[model samples]
Target: MAALSKSLLDAKKDKLPAQAAEGAHVHSSGAAQVEGDELWDKLPRTPADILRHAIKGAIRAFTLAYGARVTLAFLLRLLAVLRKKDTILGALLAAVRSQDGPRFGAFFGLFAFGWKLVSHSLREIRGIDDRWNDFVGGCVGGLAILAETPERRVSYMQQMSVRALQAIYASLHSRNLVSIPHGGAWLFALTGSQVMYAYMMRPETLPSDFYRFMVGAARVPDPILRYNCTNVRQGQVDPSIAVDLVRRYKGTADNLARAQGMSATPGVIPCAVIHPTSDSCAETNLSRWLRVFQMIAPVYASLNIVPMLTLRLKHFLTAPRTLASKAIFNTVRSSSFLASYVTIFQLCVCLHRNLHGWVERVFGRRMADSRALVFLFGFLNSAAILIEHPSRRVELGLYVLPKAVDSLFRIMVQRRLAVVIPHAEVAMFAAAMGAIMSFYQREPECMTPMMRKLMRPFFGRY
Candidate 1:
């Protein structure tokens, strides 16, 4: 009995050191974890620390935004060299040296600085952090738009307003408070109708760049469109103008003869005038679509790839195959959309010409080259928006909606139907930015994926 008791005591004593070491190890881990948390907490606990962090963040934002802007500019200039015949290396160098190139960076940095300064100051003053702080901070921060060119301030305002409105709608959508089934398609159709009508009848009312884009997409010489528009306005077609245009574009013999023989009475613009190079509208549309796709694919590819290479180098490096595949897919998709847009628009016009005789026979009246027919064809072509991915439809609609509104606004003002409000763009920008930041901090999930990706560089985590 005595030997057994001594053996048990020795066994218990042997376990004591191992248990002590294990407890010490756990305590050490706990201490390290607490220290790590303390380091994190130290970052924004004091005024000096907050200021240091904000400045550092602002600098980082500037670098990221500036680098992105410069990279995009270089790529665009390179495209210009290839497509638009811009001077090669000189244009690139000028892009780098351009004064406006750095303004985007300054805008981003100043906005970050202002947001941090205001939000943190509010927190300290109120002894609490809340959504209101973010709203106020964002409004104040948005004034940094002044850092951009006066012309760009309005563009920025319009884009941000659209995005903010989208965010707000998304937030409401989450709770089932509102919904718009197929809203993107409807919006695109509605806005696109106005845009195309303006392009045909009142090109001068459109923005210069947008006007140029339309001209290119239509694949028609500007002189022909201008001539046709004038005829429509004057309620008389001048065959001489069409003949001259066909001659200028090196139209086929049949087309040239057709243009020369057109009646002075009002008539629809001919397919020959729209696609002067080919006799058959169907063949021209098919070939032109292929050509446009080839031309536009490279531009969209650069747009997608350059941004990834510049901003997300780490991800690109980690999974080059995946990223490259995605970029290529997106490029093809976007290029297809643009190509289809052009093809469909021209096709609609050709179809209208083909069907006009049947309609006149049925109604016993000529359509008479009315602007209303042009508007109808324009509206019909918007069906091409369906070619794009459904997810991107709303984004595309939002993008074009502002341009349409701008055109309509100008038309209204010119006709004395509306008055311009001074500094309205500035006010709209501030308010929209406030709403954006509030949604960003409080419910980032409400923002579109692209918008969230865009804001992440400057705003960081919610």
Candidate 2:
């Protein structure tokens, strides 16, 4: 019995240190876990992170556009199917036999490549810390559109140019040049660029043999202004473009008229009229208008998210208190802001028209022909801001004033005043924004949550 008790005591003493060590190990693991979580919470989210997340969201949303494009391309081929020329494997073989088949494949291929290029490049161009993904995007934007024919190639470049412009616009916001809501300034940079490219960008000439293969062999229809609407089915020139081309390229209307089996008499003989496919004036006009609307469709799609998100956020925040009143107020206010941007754009368009008109009347030439008129466009665009609603005008002022101040401040700080301002660049953005908002948003009710905190010192008790 005494021997058994001694053994039991020794066993209990050995167990004590093991249990203590196990408890200490558990406590240390718990502390380490808490420290890791704290470090994660404190880490500053970079602009790259925001962009990365936004892009991922955009990819999820991109299926709609990609599917639509593929569907349209497929549908356009159905006419060939109905003619009973070839079916399925036969059609595939036929396409493989010709250059047009490859051309069709190339357009979509470059388009996809261009899309990828622009997406990645945009993020890279944002700053010095650009990642490989963004570098690929920009390079893709620049080089992807290159193809066999100049006309098709230029058309592709136009799409890329618009995308580049959009990237620049979005980059401006990302750089804090503009305060577009919910960080949405970055979302549609790609889509809007695509739209603008489709509408306004055109290559002046056809690729001749290459175009012929795409249209005749491939049965792909030529876009409306391909060859400037020249090359009638009878192999004659079109009147619309012919009249201008004759004066510029072929010498004169009378010269072209006499050369093209018509009387040389200027007043009597009509200019070249090459009608293709019996397509009437109405049909041509309708086709052109449809393409124009297609360009606008993406613009609408890209921007539609903004108002939706703004109104939703407004509703969510103003919930459970005077919801009806806020709803009515936000409906008018939010929508007007959206419309104000459109209005500003429309006003610039009008300015563009008027400037062109004045240039034509005074200078006897197109506004596009003059470099001065082009420069004036930037100035006119600046003036268009004040033309918005009063509240919108105020918001614009608040937005611009800070950036303008920061511009001057940075210059001063970078020079002799560097020592006076220990860290001007670091604090300049928020301090400037707060100062401008203080003066503009005197009414505390109008302030956002962040703005409220910022303005607290300036407007005490409010």
Candidate 3:
């Protein structure tokens, strides 16, 4: 009987599936069962895997969307360069040739004529101030005759403001003007000077108080400029009123932060140009954030400036007006001020938004990762702001000054100013773009998830 039983058992063991045996062993002890279950849970499965996939998918989507936006900006700039290529190239060629020709002599003669036109126009414009008609007329006439052909086009918008006279001559007759056109001699010279002023002068050369006033005035919308002007004249006496103004502008920062999915911490200023004077208006978090921004700003600013220097040099040499060159110059020049202004303005606005929340009696939500993303978003938005500001008008005046003077001297001496403006502008733009890209790449992880999600719809699959 034992022999028969043993034979049956052997047969049953042989017939049993391998999986079944393994399962039996797995479930035999409580510890083993728990361990087995854990192992199974750790392994990828349909639902959890789907969730993980979704998150990754979202990130990819956002990245593509951001990339597209950047590309679009670049494309638009490229289009501008294409449209302006002739003017840009002509300017370069003129700069190079100015080093060795009678062109310098003609340019100086034109510069003097342009200066006279601008002075006469300024006196008339400043006196009237109300009749834009006359101002426009004079500007048009001056621009047409004061500047040389290519420089005139560069200063097409400014015409021949006296401030621009030097720059125009410097740009055109780097060495000397061998030839000067007869049709609009004065207008052309003035235009050249305008370009010089816009491209050469530094911030320190500007009237500090006037610049500050302009900064303040920019805050007042066009519709309210007159009303605010009156209010200032009357010496209106309400601290709360000023606070309200600050608060209103401050809302812009909150909107920006929310758009980026950053926490809108209460009573914290996101950015500001003017430092806070009153302790009553202070928020600790905002103060700290400002400090961090201030610390990093110099580093970024330095990086950005490096390219600007290169662009300046390049323009001095080649003077090409290709899409690449324009992009570099515009990006660097605009970004420099934009970075400073946005940092200050946003910080102020964030503070105001936070204070408003505090006033509303809501518990302030701390930013995830302490609002690290906010900093990055502010930085990016600054690029757009820099591009749009009216200060560019002033910058144009400054940028052209040194070059115009140099050109004037060369024309008088029959020697080259030995610098190229167009190539320099282009190089500056390229360097700025490269630096910005670097900054963005360093913080790829900080990009918001929503931005990623929006990108997904476009990429098809990632």
Candidate 4:
């Protein structure tokens, strides 16, 4: 009888369902069976569900930590502004208006003076630091070349192109470029900002606010939670309600970061390796340009406002200081302030000219002859530069401000509006570029085999 009972028990145990299995039967009363079914139903949570919960929790934790820090920062700035009777923004605006005409010229003069001083100092310091001397020397050489006429500009650009090619060659041979991590803190900040923006601006597209709220309220054991949410099909969500949530949340983090004047690709290391092929080079250029635009757009958009704050602060705080110290600080600040503007101006001009020439090739019409087209192209180029210059200032302002204002304004206003507007502008610009390439430029043949070989590693994979 004992052996028979053991055999029956083993058979029953073998028939039992796995813990994660669904619809396991229980030999019990109907109520007990229903209870067992309920327990079993709770056990089969998918990994995707787990991941979703985890991501949601991570988002919350990040927002809390980041939001707190930003709030604290904004609060400090508010306090400073308040101590001045809320006149800071107005004063800054007034200062900008007053200095608009002279600021650029003033910045240039200061830059020239600094360059002279740096050059002299470096020459003197050459004995102690040869590498520094070489770098300064190279910069001086580049500047000298740039000072030449328009005809010489092409030659200078060509020379730079050659140098860039050689640098790529060296980097390829060394294999050092590929091993180095490209993006760092800036990247993290940018990624965080992107995520934040997605979440905040498009909250409806993400999971339900109630869901997030519950997770926050539940005090769940795991730091993260996973939930199985509906997926989109052709931009349509099965339950239209949930679809709206994901879209809303998709880029909320990015919007928040933008409000704070952070770059999505911050801390991206400069690319050193050059692809030997034309296709690879083009790909590399595209990637580099995208990164540059990402970094540049916000700064440019905020330029008009940034200079005002800097100038106002300088005028208000340093008015009592010695003229020499004031002048020194002003000179240093001015040059650094305008560096982005100068760089962007140069880059845009170069790109515009190149695009114009390329357009001329395909259309068989001189770009210069069409005044309207020229003006339109010129305007777009200028707009691009303008948009790329001020992002840093806004970022700096957010960083310096106190937390309370930061959180409130950033969450409610800047993240929702300011960031999205600029991004739209960037998207438009990209679309315009694509249209121009498709319609205006002639399709070229594939690069040579040797060039292909060289480019394969760097550009081909992408």
Candidate 5:
């Protein structure tokens, strides 16, 4: 009995040490976990960190924008060289050469500086922790577009305006007020600029474009000048008008044969000068409306018997889409902005044609361009614009009035001053389509040959 009691005591003593060690192990693990969490909490979320991340995002954005611009310029330059329009290593050599290389460097700087400023502002607005990954990756796109508009094309005043406007847009995107998708950023900028230019800013103080319009060849893209081909001064149409407008008018029925290829120079093509009439208002109004009408004509140009397919595709690959693409989806569903605008435009156009027919029956043919007739036509166009999109006319008004008022003001008041900004954003918007005309001029065969001819002044017909 004594031996058994001693053995039991020894067994119990050994068990206590093992149990205590297990408890100590668990405590050690818990202590280690607590310390790990404390270390994480102590890490800094400093302004320096935020700026570093913001800069990372800015650098990424600038890299993409600059790359795209440089690539485009390189391709264009290469094409020119290949076509024998330029020297063999013209752009390629210029890309490396110190003096010539500065153009691209400046081009790169525009986006880099613009985005860096935008990113720092955005970092504060979003309050996002700086991670290696930039959440707003490449959001500052379209910077290349600004660069594409050659420095020569943009005046200082216009550049200032654009910079201010672009700053607003970038800030909004950074703040997420204007989201990346659905063109919200673009919409905001467009609306804001319109308001600033029309109501807030006195456009009259701005420099004039009419003098340019009157003395220089009518800008080929001038809707009033391009469409009617009348009222625009003869020989004053930019020579590019020959390539653009097809020389619709002739000196007389007998002179049609001699009018072919009037000339390759810009603003030199013969077009009818506006016959001085009190109804110039109607003519101007009608032409402006017609320009917008043509812009939306594309959607109606084709017919699709089964439009529902677009919706099914949208439901499939759910990546981000464009305004036009979203419109396509809505179209397939039987209702969309496109459908609404198309229906309205078509109905109004038909009504105008019917009304014109009635007028022809009542009045003589010579009254076609009469003030009353032209005014009615202009009113119908205005109605179509309202019907298609309620805000469209207001947008157009905002866009044009500022310039019109400014130009008129300049002509009457600041008659001697140069263009306030050689070309304002609104002016650029109007001439956006004409910007493509540069492709023709850039093309070696089209422009380089002519340029060579001009350069070799002494060698005739070379």
Candidate 6:
């Protein structure tokens, strides 16, 4: 019994050192974790060190911005070459000669430099770091927009304002402070009305790309658009305008006679004038939609395909077949949606023309080509938005809202209904930049997924 007791005591003594070593290991690991969790601003840094870091960050930002622009240009030009619109050498030259890349790089780089410097300096001054410092820093940084050409400043300001508003709404929604069912669809419809009106009545007010898109979708000669606008403003239809349309559509004079007889108010534009290409409105709309789908499919496909191939090469390589299939699917889906939009709008206009004739016949009064009718048709046509992907609806709504607002403001100013404030765009841009920066730092989840993704490389994730 004494020998057994001695053996147990010796075993217990050996276990004691093992337990002590395990405890020490755990404590050291815990201390290292705590150290690792320290906030960035809490780190010691001299003023000169901070400036050095800012400059380095700025260069990184510049490289990223410049690279992205060059990449996009190269891809687009390559597409043109593929279509035989340009040669390969021409495409390369176009990519190489992209003047806007340096400007974009400068704006982004300077903004990064200013943002880091100001935010870090404020923390040193106040001996505390908070989101407000980030906001102020962002505002100062946004002044780097001046690095862009004057023509681009207003455009950037408008885009930022829209994005800021969207971010605010997202934040409110996340907190349950705001809730509205089908709110995005409603917003799209409302803003879309203004956009359609501008497209018809004031195409000049729209951005160049938007105006060109409208022209292409309409598939009408410029003279026809001008004539239609004039007639709509006059609130009367002119049979005389049908002569040129009849010729353009390859219809005989007898077609105009048939149109006048079929139309209740001769002044109201006939179906032949609206869709002069085919006798059946339904058939015409179907063919137009199919044609647009075919035309845009390649464009959308390239847009998705190029980015995946170039920007996400690693991910693409890892799952080449799957990624390629998904990109193709998305391209088809987006093309279909855009085709539906254009066709639906045209169909709605044709419906409006018929409705105008019916109303005039019933009431025995001319109300054709009225602004009220135009606006009503525009609102009705926005229902095409229902066919778009649910996730994309809000994004599309936000995109068009700013343009609509710009058009409204322009119309108001033209009619002397509103006074223009000097440098209003500049002030708005600065304020919006501040809000955007604060959201980027303190409430990144409030930003759109695309916006957050674009910013992560520059700002770092929270």
Highest TM-score: give the candidate number.
1
Model 2 residue runs over 4 Å out of place are 1-74, 92-133, 136-158, 173-462
Tens-digit per-residue lDDT, 326-440, candidate 2: 4445444444443433333234333443364455567664333333432233333344343344443443444333333333344455565644444332233222222232222
For candidate 1, write residues 325-422 as lDDT tens digits. Answer: 99999899989988987788888778877776776677544454566776676667778778777768888888888888888999999999999998
Clash counts for all predictions: 0, 4, 89, 70, 9, 1
User: Tens-digit lDDT track for model 5 on 285-340?
Assistant: 34434543343333222112112122223543454355446555433432233233
* Residue-by-residue lDDT tens digits, candidate 4, 27-97: 34566566654654442133343334334433333333333333333333444475676665654444445
Highest lDDT against the true fold, candidate: 1
lDDT of 1: 0.77
Clashing pairs in 2: 117-137, 120-134, 121-137, 121-138
The TM-scores of all predictions, comma-separated, are 0.86, 0.26, 0.21, 0.17, 0.31, 0.84
Point out the worst 10-residue segment of candidate 2 by lDDT. 195-204
Q: In model 1, what is the error at residue 146, expressed in angstroms?
A: 1.4
Q: What do the candidate models score in CA lDDT, each in turn?
A: 0.77, 0.36, 0.35, 0.32, 0.35, 0.73
| lDDT at position 438, candidate 6 | 80
Q: After superposition, which runs of candidate 5 have C-alpha atoms over 4 Å from their true positions? A: 1-51, 63-316, 319-325, 329-380, 390-406, 409-414, 417-462
Across residues 214-290, which tens digit of lDDT does each residue of candidate 3 receive?
A: 34422322222322332323433333333444444453444333324322221232233122222232353345434
Better of 1 and 2 by lDDT: 1
Q: Is candidate 4 or candidate 6 better by TM-score?
A: 6
* Model 6, span 349-388: residue lDDT tens: 7776668757767764445556666677667777777876
Which model, 1 or 6, shows the larger TM-score?
1
How far off is residue 58 in model 5, in Å?
2.1
Q: Which residue runs does candidate 6 get wrong by more than 4 Å?
A: 1-44, 248-265, 306-311, 362-368
The better-scoring model by lDDT among 2 and 4 is 2
Model 4 worst lDDT run, 10 consecutive residues: 268-277
